[model samples]
Target: MDHYSFFDRDLSWLLFNERILMEAEREDVPVMERVNFLSIYSSNLDEFYRVRMPVILALNKLAKGGKQEKEDVLLEAQSLIEKQQQKFGQIFTSKLIPLLKENKVTLLFNEQPPNEIQSKITDYFFSQVMAFLQPIDLSETGKNFFPENNRLYFLVSLTLKDNSKKTILLNIPSNQLPRFYSVSSDDQQFILFLDDIIRHNLHRLFINEKVTGCYSFKITRDAELDLKDEYHGDLSEQIEKQLLKRDMGMATRFLHQPNIPLHTLHFITEKLSLQGSSVVEGGMYHNLKDLMGLPVSLPGLRYSRWQPLTNDQLIDAPSLFEYIAQKDCIFHTPYQSYNSILRFFNEAAIDANVQEISVTLYRVASDSRIVNALIGAALSGKKVKVMVELKARFDEANNIKWAKKMKAAGVEIIYSDKALKVHAKVALVKRLVDGRIKYAGLLATGNFNESTAAFYTDHILMTANPFLVREMELLFVFLAKKAKTSAGYPIEFKHLLVAQFNLKDRFLELIDREIENVKKGLSAGITIKLNNLEERVLISKLYEASQAGVKILLIVRSICCIIPGVKGMSENITIHRIVDRYLEHGRIFIFNNNDTPEVFLGSADWMNRNIYRRIEVCFPIYDQHIKTEILKIIDLQLNDNVQAVGLNENLQNVILEKHEPLIQSQQEIYHFLKQEIYDRV
Candidate 1:
């Protein structure tokens, strides 16, 4: 049994979201940047409910009366989410908006209006926003109104003097039009929500009946689409059809204003038949995630943009291939330019000895220059094969678009079995050097997207080791055949932890070693940095190790289930979460076997889907200097008292207080890297 056997995974994820909110609530952070953090927190919560919570809820409903534990966890998750929503309300209303007002920006509503400014808003709405108003009458249509995913809606309840009440749903055209409408009169910039603009023009929207009141609201649906393997058609066409069906998915959540009347709430819930579903009562503003792009337009309100810094190694090298031949190089994205990854493919495309290029396309940019480079390679008589996964959620349409384009350019496209989505981010290049097969591969922790690479923290390893290259080429062949038995690629691996075979064993062995070492009175410990940690077996192993007196420190970015510091169960376990300016990605696991530690960097987290299902690799750090550098970064994050949150025995996120000077690890890392560049220069 795990130390955190009682701790729920869904509730732990909500705590992660709360840490993001803490960043927004920090007085030390820039105001506009804090607003962006708030938007990210909201967006993250939306995805949590859309993907995770619904599945948990569904899982609870299975086995009928049994599994009291699952039901209790769900109830706890629901309660925690409501608490977070209330905190979000307080932060947005009491703090962020007021700060914006101090900067002369106003988020206006209908009730609280200066008389002088009411006319300006009224005239602006009638002229510009009235044409966009399309209200749906629930009584007239006599059908349930369902909202599209992430789309905004208005819940208007009307009370006539004769006591006959009517309710309607209004669609706010924020996605089509701008969410924030800026109006300038004298000095102040009056920015109104798209819903508020429609609200001001309500007298015109209602034809005959008097408009009593209006409130902003919206509904979030379960965005998961069930695209089974039975569909015998073009995957792209099938995905396009699913994209259309997504808007009409079951409404899992109803987000509405708190002040809404009881009858009105009953009316909407009964009409939509949302009898057993979750109903989340929220503040006046429905979709605060839109505030990420708040149209601040003011230069000083946000952080100054920093141009991506190129690696000094790239600048000093004779050529990319030549440099790889000498030594392996890792490009940590955003800090190091994504242009280097692009250059690797582009150079391969133009190299004379290059024979073939194979890549796994999980998620790529719409305007992907990398795909264009692959197309160029194919056009230049290079055998280019792309295993494009068309099932990546939210990016399926974009992946489908790229697939059609790549296929049209004469590239061999391999579609994986629909049951398993190929999520490995790998690109392999085979070149004939003196008539011998020489290969180069790019393995990354994030999607091969240049735009997100600028903001997301990911590690891309570019290497040409013959043994590793041979394995990578074999892996590509396996991927092409969808890992079939007839595929020539061997399943045996000593240096790589490839999933479906050896990864789980390797991880379990590492934990078991720690447990044994602790029992032997030797120094034993484990340090892990991962995006999420929720695998039951893995968590249970950590608990067993902790019981054996093996110290464990986990820096999990999100979705942790292993409760730390339980008195008799997990006294040696500690969990830390770092929420800084840069996302803490790059999964690294270290096992301290009496001070002779083994460190590995990988493309997989400890989540069950990654360990048991996905084709993930955990490769050992060979270069001593690189290992030192990665360890240094991890240590900095561990020592961070500013952005770090400690999870206690009760699974509570408690911020560590420091009486001395603060050390923000992200900023410290920037300075650390800058110093390295300076020393090299």
Candidate 2:
């Protein structure tokens, strides 16, 4: 047997999703916040069915160890989901609804509108909801109406004038209208679902028929995009073509409300060609992700808001570039404002000294200020080069839109090859200052998205370090050539640890160094924070280090395959996850180099795709102050007893026991940065 064990990646992800459900069930969590978690849980589970369930089903079919084994695993997985769904129903109907009713708002789940608001509901349905309704009769033979993926539809069962059963599929119109309809009558306020609104008005639509049942349902299709010839044609065009066909992939799950008749269920399954798909019996609601539309402004029902803090140096500096040239500075987002990073690009766009700006964009925001800055820079006769990864899943259309806009504005847009994706979040600005070509850069642990910056916890670094900036420019040049090289691109990256080249090797060397230090009776440890951890080579190296008496601490938010606290395998490894108001997204790696620590931050997670199929950049921290700040923040997270939960050998997230002072890391982080600003003042 091997010295270490690994959990299945998909099941590990399911465990992470389960943690979200657990958050929804927490009484201490603000009721609206708990509702938000419920929405997030539903959204995440839907995506899992779209993306991962197809792989699981296919593997089960092709398993050589008899279909019985795979069948048992499937049944186990199904059982887990059923229990979660039951819990979801209990929490939403029993706990949350009553809690909201106490606060003077009524969310009509399965119930009809109150007698006081009956006429108003009828009027609103006629005037506002009728324009978006396009119901189709299933008895029609040739019209071929396909149900889109994860879209809400109601199977209306009717008894016609001839005393025969007829089924019609009517859309919930959530895409066009709001998922919720909020109305008030005197002292009481009621929130209604569009699904319930339509269900209440079903009799008016079928005047001659008796409406028996109106049940909610949806079909979740595989989200895998077909890009077979993506490398051949225009990459953006190919993605555009594939986006049209994405919703038509094989059905992975067919979810419906529990009260549908057997004949109606059979009719939908056969007509939609979802014969072998996993059919789930659900509550009256199909997509509870729509719960996010609920009002979060209810007093005492939401977490207290903390305004983002500004980087004093960056904001007060007369020249943002000059301050960075003097010393490297870093900003933590959601805790710190994103204006400093924005100023980085906004300054480069109009600066007369700046000649060229180049960057790699993985997921561009829909309304991106950075892209607009690049457009302005290019239009101002400055050379702007952008490598936009057309394969950024689910955001392909948005990225393609921005790429075309940038290209049209004279900004050179480089499309990454189909086989390799450049996931480096790095940007460089070249300036001719004082008759010298000066280089400055911005590196980050997340995408350059201002929208996500409001909620995603990330670290952004601004530096005038010549070596790293020069290496970033070299990377842009290499990416422009499609990154096609026989032996790792021939260029040596000394400052940046780049994947597909020195990344894996350098990480192994780091882990091995810790193990060697342990052998020397020196202080040795490895602390890493990542969104996911699945690459086996680095995991095995970590296991080897753990066996050599190196203490490993990990803060993984999701999808961790490494099992911790296993006897004789990973006894020294401690892993925990922190779920809070904002997403824990930053990736940090710290190596205890005999008390003098080394820290690195990057966008790369040690997943299989990051190691082999992508070009990721993880950069070392040379500035002492920035490194210390990162270490302190990570230390706070390590000591967090409120939001953090430790993982056991069974891959279960166990709540950490609270001590004298509970450290909620995100809250503490905010205060820490606030204190730093105060100290600087």
Candidate 3:
């Protein structure tokens, strides 16, 4: 039996956010990119409160017998968030502000505008921002007011001539207009927040009354959709209804300016019936996420851009099918172009031999060329079946809209089973090649969205291997018929690792094999790269392997619960996390099966939700060349001391000591892929 100790999941996630903040603090990073990291941190926190806090809140409610476990977790999360927020303010104010000024761009927060830009700011406000202002008298509305979720607003205190005061609520039209307005004056550029512009003109709205104070505030509501387990109607319809109710869910965090008076805060909370714990005192500006859109275009202030490399194999091929037929191709995205994956579908749409197209859509781009190709295939009389998962959080509407558009174009649309979400990123194409049906499939570790593909590090395998293609066909057939079957129906996959079927068992078996190899005095090890590692069963297995002298290396990007470097438990295990210009989103697993290693890459992470609840696929890397390429990439990441942080005994992120040459994995991988293109040429 493996006695296990686990880090709290939410706290582990917060540590990842801290790593992001550390990037912002790095002097070597470009100034604007540092500011962008701040935006990313703020945005991540908003989502954490929206999504994860509700679960904690529910657990708190369910702790009926005075059990404070959930409450303690929430309090710890709150404390950690507060500390990070302070660090954010310090970095922004002390470091980034000076850097921006040196670069001749000014980001004005709560200060008075310079004399040179005062008139321009006033003129721009009336011309662009005045029409969107609608101030509600909060005293008159009393308890009847509700702020929209995540929207920025201001609470104003007005002083009248009769020595009386009134409070009003005004919405900052950030959604309708750009949050940062750029103005150039006297050869210097100025970026002002929409909140500041509204603050400057608060008196203009109330002509008779004097505006005493205007403070920014925003509420993050519970974003969890309340979809019941048993629903009679369509899942898409149910999701649409739930999405509408999402905005009105319980307020998880009520963030107000720290300078707001105690009386005002009390009145506001009382009016909204908010609990004391829900109120969080924040900065003068609520939504600092707007910093990402700061209109500064200085050349050296941003990170040097690199164009995605064109895959050598597909660049000159007459047809993607022909190119993929001769050999399997792997696309390492953001480093390599996503065009190869796009071309795969584009060719299938136009190819005369193509007869069937099937793919799973979890979250797609708003203007997806993949969907366009599927529509084209359907219109051209080819059989097209798309399983669009409508339950992808925050993307439900976009997925549903695209599903309708494809359905209107005569494409067969498949909705996922209500009990499970189809999280796999796999596609299958059948073509009549030389009078026989040939299968070409796409299995990826990321979504099919081109927008994210440009910046998310993922792997896509385009292959014509019969064994994998046959299994992919079976998986899609299972997905299509999943709604009609009983819950206990077994799906046996030989070539693929699928969740809720054989994925967990296969992982345990693989670990056990490594343990057996170690027992037999043969070399054994495991290397895994995933976005998260929170499943206790798998962690225990890895611990068992470590106790048996099997080495393990993990590159988990976020939410790692397993504590590495512990004595007698996981001493042989090491965990490294990398955060860089590109998000590390791929899942790659390598097992040293007595020198003849086995490698697999796919969309599934070692998380409870991914392994037991969601429908995911992990496909084997059969092509030895592709497996070698993946191993090389993994080696590059392992050698990354610049952006990689090792997990210490306390699960804190500590910068790995630099070796010679200071290798950054993302840059090195790009160079490696570029070299491969040159070598092929």
User: Candidate 1 residues 1-681, lDDT tens each?
Assistant: 522464667888888898898888887787889889989988988888678867776776773567554454677788888888888878878898898888888867435556767787777777777777677778665667666776888877665566676777888888778888777667777777777767767766775566776766666778887777588867678788989898677777778887877877887788877766678887777778888878777667777665666777676776788788777778776776788899998998999989999998888887899999999988888999999988888898888888888888889988876666677777888888897877787878788888788777887888887767777777786877776332345567777677776788889999999989888889889999899898888888888888888989899888887778887778888989888767877788899978878887878888877876577777776667667777877788888888888888787789898846677677666667666666657
Pairwise TM-score winner, candidates 1 and 3: 3
Q: What RMSD value applies to candidate 2?
A: 1.7
Task: Please list the Cα RMSD from the true structure of every candidate, rounded to 1 decimal place.
Answer: 2.6, 1.7, 1.5
For candidate 1, give the lDDT.
0.79
Alpha-carbon deviation at 544 in model 3, angstroms: 0.9
Specify the poorest-scoring 10-residue window by lDDT in model 3: 482-491
Clashing pairs in 1: none
lDDT of 1 at 641: 84
Per-candidate TM equals 0.94, 0.98, 0.98
lDDT of 3 at 260: 91
TM-score of 2: 0.98
TM-score of 3: 0.98
- Candidate 1 RMSD to the real structure: 2.6
